[model samples]
Target: MSIRALVYGDVDLNTVDGSAVWAQSMTRCLAAAGCEVTLLLKTRVGNERLTAPLDGAPGVTLRRPYEESLLDDLGPRGLTPEQAVALITRLDSERRFDLVVLRGRRTAAVAAHTDALAGRLWTCVTDVPQTATGLTSAVVSELTDIAVASRLLLCPTEELRGFLESSVPAACGKSVLFPPVVVPPPEGAVGPGTPRTPLRIVYTGGFAPRWNTLEMTGLPAALGRRGVPAELHVIGDGIHRDPAEWAKRMGRALEDTPDLVRHGGRPHEEALRLAAQCDVGLSWRAPEADTDLELAAKVPEFGALGLPVVLNRTPMHEELLGPDYPLYAGEDLDSVADALVLATDPQTYRSAAQRCADASGRFTLERAVERLRGHLRLALPPAPGGVAPERPLKVVIAGHDLTFFTGLAEHLMALPGLEVRLDEWEALHTHDQYRSRELAAWADVVVCEWCGPNALFYARHKRAGQRLLVRLHRFELHTEWPRKLDIEKVDAIVCTSPYYADLTRERAGWPADRVAVLPNWVDVDQLDRPKLPGAQHTLGMIGIAPSRKRIDRGLDVLAELRRRDPRYTLAVKTKQPWDYWWVWNRPEEREYYERAYRRIQRSELLADGVVFDPYGPDVAVWLRRVGFVLSTSDDESFHLAPAECAASGGIPAVLAWPGADTIYSRRWIHEDTGAMADAIHSIVTEGRFDAVRAAARDEIAAKYSLRRVRGLWTDLIISGGFPEPVRPDGTVPAIR
Candidate 1:
């Protein structure tokens, strides 16, 4: 299928300028590359002349705000950059464009910062801080902001790309080279003749002083001194940077110079024709031209006209013409003169022009088409062969609480061709049977988040050819839910850790091949927030339900720490036993929580130290005040509190439950409450809490990153197959 593209440039195509010409080339080339393009145009006056080439071009369609009467509605600055973004939104809503190419910095910046478009942007930013020192704190920040808005940062020259990626960290790896294109000559245009006397040299483009246009007239005098009289013709009307001064300077330079002829601006075709008539072309620019990271558009245009050009001897020019090309010239009159005199030599002239011809070949329309196709390919990569069908696999994820798997769900939903449906059970044991059965029949795969009644129901009632997967956490493993599951019908059992997988296999009598481990995804970026002052004194515990979470042990650690440092406090962020009707009904569970509360109130240190924060989805925020997260359970499938704490830039003081070391580092685990107190005190006294936090954060990020885990889940859901088994140490293998 052809790629659908939305192209926008904040340029007026009615004029014959570089930006205008670039827009024209871009629109034509995108169509050539097989894209069904909607080129949103911003035209001043009229664009009939400029857009003539694209009038009947297949695969190219034009949309102008002026023609749409949006210009009349929005008033001046016709098709403003922000309006461009709005137009993109409107068109995208009508029919999604697979790719978006943004050329103007203002439009790109607005789109990027607004997040109106996310990773779909293929942004081309020509102007940015160039020098290392020029990238001040503010400039770096600005560049970083824009960097996130684009999937690729398009550069016309490798030198510029290298500079940007090296200086601005945000640009690294995202920068790509898309060289300046040479617009193909008009059909049936004239070609250059053999070398002639009174060597005719032409310079065409904007009369920017930076381009050194005024200095070219002196080349005739310099060439004459060398006994080679040269006729210098200059074409262009536009002026940049102090236009009045440039006009005055250029007028004085051109007046009464018999060898010099200045022609006002004309169409691009006329300029090319004039260039072909000349013996050689001039692209010389000022000493301080912004050429370090940019290439002169006219340089290749001169080459396309089969005319050897003299320009600033920069790296980009050297890359185009070999470093030893005979026509290399500096901006000064003598250097250009010296090169013009050399062009008088037939052997030198033909060789330089031949090099020009060869260099221009790289920028031909066909090559540009291929490069652009490659860029689009990289931007939107296809799924692995045979793994992802053109039609998305219908996946239904059923669970009471989808909080744990939300990231994975979102990832699957965003995937190119993966349809994800959720069967949210009212409770672990209950759901609308009719809806559940209907979803089971429709889904290619049904994933039960917990091995509860949902898994058993799906295993028993799943339609033929539909794969069923069940995730087993700690609580569900102890229940009879696993024994009831139809092991033969179940495709795979997902365990968060290796120890739990072993337990699931042993207790449920499920075969090893049927069980696979995919750990929980931690939203690290969300959790990694700055901590409040005195956060080191606060100990945090997420849950203490039915007393198995060992909130008493957390209070014990706090009590012991406060004996040495009274600043240390225990903050239990959990739902009280009374809040849960099931746990409250258990006499032992009620007694356990009552006893833990009595101990916290009775003990002198823990009385003032222990404070219970309400449980909610705002754990990341609550962790800001928590320096050390405590997990004192007797056993765990995979206690996520400590890993999440580590992710939130806090050290975890965990009691070494059985198999705990497999998932958490030994440095974080202690044999008892006394050892836990000692570790926390030492970190506090030595001011090593920051170092410990960094280390723990790194470890958690490497292990439980949402991006990696989401990918594993995607593989499992898409392929209806298990990923590699978890190692004995709880480490998952990289997806192959």
Candidate 2:
């Protein structure tokens, strides 16, 4: 089957810009994958003349919708939404495309309207809204709607995924395909004969508000003060202002730094060549901003050219480069200055550069395009490997959380021809039930959730004949378990989020591909119902303990709300206190647990409007009365409270857990709570209870529904060829 793709965006392949670099590399990769790619460049005024074909990218075909005269008249202001849409519609009418990939706001708007295009349609969103600007909000809303409505939405980073999922109703079940950065060999692969006069540090790429250009200029001065002989080279023109003017201002700010050489803006290859010779590359971005979510492509480009990078600590980089990458946190000048001092040391810089390069392999064009092809299969089937015939399969689920195990078992039981066994083990502090050889011999596939005892058990029991899958929930590694567990014993380690998978790979030293991501599934059909009475004023929180769950935050929100409105009541369902005591290794620590539990219990008892309930089977039914569910967690793998609450027709106001954000985002949370007080106020004042409830149900029904999740599990099991007991309907019998 010939794969034909049409990419629409403001891409100028001739220029050495970030978008251009991406377009060129992606087009090349698609071509290499035997896909015929046509790039439709949305030319702005004066930028039309900049349209030129990339040198090595022969497989890419470029076309401009508007003439050079019209584009030139528009200048840097660019095309309006209506104009861009009209142009894309015209192009769509002329050519039938198999896949239409849109970029940016205007182009996405255009592609959204092009229903005439055949095959699946996808949009690549590169921005997020942090401020309350009208245009930003409008674009965000449009993109959100597009994401919710479109066939696929591709995001470059987990941070962006979080932002999109929280803000956009459309991203609920979306597949996030991280963007790749192509690294071409440096111009001078071999070093010069003699030592260079001075160590050169380069900063290339367009100047944007998020680039924090002023900080880049100050870097040279900082390095000089640290007694390092370095020259600063500024490359790439700015989109907003002249690159030359910005360079001049930077040079002046550095007191006319003697070795500084400002080359304004050069071609991509030339800039890369210069960067390769430099000892270090500098880039900075604010984590809270939208632009930061779209990692600056330059970081990888610098790495590809063998230059050590000094960048701001953004979630995007953290996802791609891992936590150990050399990064300076915060936006303070001193932090940047300190990084500059460390970056100038050739040995240190070179080692860091090598690490960056090694990491870059994961995001290579070849890898990204291959992954994209696999994900896009959801929309378009492969010519040869269409969905295989369903068959009976044996699956085993191992976990401590009875609720999770029950939920999964119920979902699996609903599926036809699939036999799933629940492997329950007593707590490590209790009887050593996990050591039972019968349990190991009884199952074909063993699924272990959480690290500790389960990981150790897997190491002891798993052999060449057995299939072992271990799941790392939030902060499981933060404990000493990952360090102590023999990870090599497991066949596969599953994580709920790619971010966590990457984290595990780094911290646990696991193979990249071994860490598979299988997000938490929900039973959506169960949630289709009207809200229960008192749902408008009743808020619910599910979970016990405070250290990791951050239940205190939820209590704080409830306390503040109750002070303002007596009508507002909070209900909490905590696990039986004795159950925790039984599971805890140190029974003496029961005092510590009891003391903390009593405080929460006492708070609820003292508060006239608060109610605390013990965990029970009817918890789901009770959750229906909760107008909102609170997730005040410090850590989670994939918190089921918000998802369950949503299923139960409850609104969810969630804060970013320390590690949860790596898997689920604020978007998955029914309502995002950046601040506790603000969140409580909104839930009380804004009558968005219905909207939140509806949105939550819609998300669960589409992505996490048992029907949908059953198919995913069936596909995996059938593909892997697991044995199971056959039923009357030729389906797998449910193992009780």
Candidate 3:
């Protein structure tokens, strides 16, 4: 029997934006999987202009809110809490839904009102608790109450499951790890031929700050310097400025190098087509943004297109690219140039591209949709409101912050049904305690954060009834953390990106089924901005550490810029004297700190104009003043600094490091210090800084908005089997 499901979110199904594309792909996947899927979108004012069909997928229907005030109703202007409850009641009375899947906080609340039909309700939660607002809070509370009172719950990643398990007691027994549905490649897509004319390098995304378009343009210019035939095609709308103006500015910068091509923005199909024409795909992420989950969708798209990728050596990339992939680049231009040279060779890159294509098949939308369908089948039987015998649910949390533990404790305290506690314990001078065995005994579940070094050891000691879950960040592979973690004993591991999850599972000796990928969350309301001009010239960096953060690397770029023009003043937020020692061991700390301190002291001596803000007190003010933000991390999980800088309307100058490339495209970096200096000069002297900042902010607000992430989290969590209800009926849920 086929299941009928209702999916609701704020994505524009007609557009080519990431969220819209995801929604469209999901709709297609669900339809292809033989599920009757109706998508309910919050009607926006200009939505009529975007009335494209939902890709003509079978078993799919698209609907808008009845009153046209759904967005307002979700916020302060529309429905009051009591009115919302009444409206939800009225709506459910009209339609008999066998299953209702909530996408975000607002939609989740609507699902919650159907508690009487709790046997049929499923809530999908995406990000951490930090992203939602009072409205989201209300919806989450309702969903939590329903999960506690209902039959089934789904979590996308173990990270989210841990969060839900701690936030709502009803989630303890029902939760399961279900990653997002992977979209399939279009049919008949073939790999590109050898670099025939110009070595066409394509970057298919918006010209956002995170895209680091200026830095990207500089690479082609750098190639021009080396006398290599290279051209860059940027195929997306201007996230910050008018497409024409952005093209004009970028075009002028590359006028001396005839090989460079700035194709500006194109429609989704057109962009993909353009990308197909290229020999290489350049994708990257901001190392500091902590939002690398966005890249999960793009990586498959690149592979499906059959383009060899010049990726940043992030853990996600390392996981996704496999061993046969091309070389990993650091922050230096020579490193990127070396990678570029290798990638330009058809013999070297073609096989790797094929490998990427092969890998992409594993994550195709059809497979993901089928996986989700099976999970739903297992989840649907018990129904929402049914009650069954209760048993002690064993859970294990591997690694995380103290606040996370406290949060979990608070959530468990609210629910009296299941007992929960931490499973392992270690004391670190940095955070007070590293791990605790006492906490492990108390925990029915074990939760762990895959910080570094200790993940494998903790994974090895799992006992029966205790499921081991390792939450991964970007730094897992770059450091020795993966080496130390025991993968065989881990019941499940969660990642923010599928690329990362797949990689972690591959390396850790864990079953493929044991890994789950979920997106991270951010506070949307706090990301609000006051209208300001984008021409600010001040540059900012918000991280404190040196080694992987590559603080010295950023200073080098700045120093190069200053050598050309003494007026180039850069601002940095450095590590506190005490925190500097925490990143490395005593011996490594001494070596790294001495080098970093000397570099900082030397930069200060060389450029008295450079300013250092150790305490980040003026971050807000500096954010407004800065035209650019720099990220030079040698390694990273997801850097929050660059994202925050872009959100504050600053253009980003990112080091083309490994983990960061997975988040942003490589087109954002210069191949060398000279190129970096030149790009900086162009931005400052050519008045392009305004456009960069404008594009940066728009991209963050629209594409990486906390709201979009929240929706993704909801989908992943619900699809993963968290908050599933127990029923008297003899129905078993599918685990794969």
Which candidate comes out best when scored by TM-score?
A: 1
| Candidate 2 structure quality by residue, lDDT tens digits, 1-736 | 5667777655554345677666656566666666677776655324322334343355677655454343334444445556665555566667655677766765665556555542256777764454345336677667755764466777775455555655554564554656655656555742222224365667787665456765666655665677766677777665544566766664464456566677765655566666666666777664445244566777777667666677877545665677777645458666876776765555556667777777667667778767666554445443222232264455667666555545456545434455667656677334346444566766666777677676677678765676777768766878888888776777677676556777789998988756766556665533433455568778787765634565556666666676667677878887744566444656554555566556656775325766777665445445656777777766665677777777767665667665544433355442333365466557557976577577766655554555555455444444532212121121233321
Clashes of 1: 0
**Candidate lDDT (C-alpha), each:** 0.79, 0.61, 0.55
Q: Which stretches of candidate 2 lie over 4 Å from their true place?
A: 11-15, 44-58, 66-80, 117-119, 131-140, 186-197, 242-258, 285-291, 315-335, 383-736
Over 4 Å off in model 3, which ranges? 44-56, 65-91, 105-124, 129-184, 211-214, 238-270, 290-295, 331-337, 382-736
Question: Candidate 1 at 732: error in angstroms?
Answer: 23
TM-score: model 3 vs. ground truth: 0.44
Worst 10 residues of 2 by lDDT: 721-730
Error of 3 at 56 (Å): 5.2
For model 3, residues 570-678, the per-residue Cα lDDT tens digits are 7776665457455655676567657766775676434475677655333443454566677776655556566667776666676765445554434445565567667
Please list the residue runs of candidate 1 whose C-alpha ends up more than 4 Å from where it truly belongs after superposition: 73-78, 187-194, 241-243, 251-257, 381-391, 394-415, 419-717, 720-736
* TM-score of each candidate structure, all chains considered together: 0.58, 0.52, 0.44
Query: Cα deviation in Å at residue 358, candidate 2?
Result: 2.6
